[model samples]
Target: MAVATQTMTDEQRKSVALEYLKAFDNAGTTSTGGSILDLFAEDAQVMFPKWGLATGKKEIGQLFTDIGGTLTSIQHHYSEFTWIFSGSDLVVAEGTSHGEHRDGPWRAGVPEWGAGRWCDVFEIRDFLIQRCFIYLDPDYAGRDTARYPWLSQD
Candidate 1:
């Protein structure tokens, strides 16, 4: 982990948050997985509502890597994402990520594709993100599969 001795301020924290939004914008239709790291601190961790918890930059990176493999690449458009500043060292942002399949798991379903929204709580430190907890529902994927003949239930 890189050590940053600079004091973290609200302005710096907010500015750093933009990188996360930028990462989603740059992902385009292909899930690079690595780009999302811009949002987290090197030791940052995220706990998915159903997917479980992941820690460290490398681990978090790998988790998204698997996600990239499961679904076609899609850019996350975060609308209505705002930071709730908690003592300048913490901020929580909740928003939606909507995109269409361009590669894996959800394709061949509904002919209309799918999208999801996530709620995230972030813990910030030294102008870098230290932790993030994410919540999502893959129930939509199952629903899409059962409804689309092109998708295999198996």
Candidate 2:
């Protein structure tokens, strides 16, 4: 595996991170004409809520497949995205999204504290993502309300 060199500028790193998001939004489609995995380094690590941590490309592919299988569609609100640069390799992106899960659909701000809101912290270098940790509620359908008294329908 090629070593990741810290040669990309902040703007370039931001661009790569954005590209990852774009590819994720267009996943399983021919629009991007490329696999999302292409944006990651061979030894890249990824973390998703409930999915734990995945190391390397092979594990990352499995992680994506697991999550993608449950979502019918997803669209990130690019206009609402908030970006933070760490003056180094770290780039954080916070945004809202609307999507269809296997059970139902969800949109950010609908019911205030539901799904759709998310934040992802990424470490980019050599024009590829070296690490990405996603933070978000996975319950798109709000079916897990039973665990929270406030969210309970009854």
lDDT of 1 by residue, 1-154 (tens): 4566778877677666656655645551214365567667777887755567788878877776655545544444445676688885777766555444433233222334453555667667776678777666554354546666766545
Candidate 1 lDDT trough over 10 residues, lowest sum: 102-111
Please, what is the whole-model Cα lDDT of each candidate in the order they appear?
0.60, 0.88
TM-score of each candidate?
Answer: 0.65, 0.93
Top lDDT model: 2
Candidate 2, residues 1-154: lDDT per residue as tens digits?
A: 4675558888898888888888777873333587888889999999999999999999999999999999989999999999999988899999999999998999999968889999999998888889999999999877888889877856
Lowest lDDT 10-mer window, candidate 2? Answer: 23-32
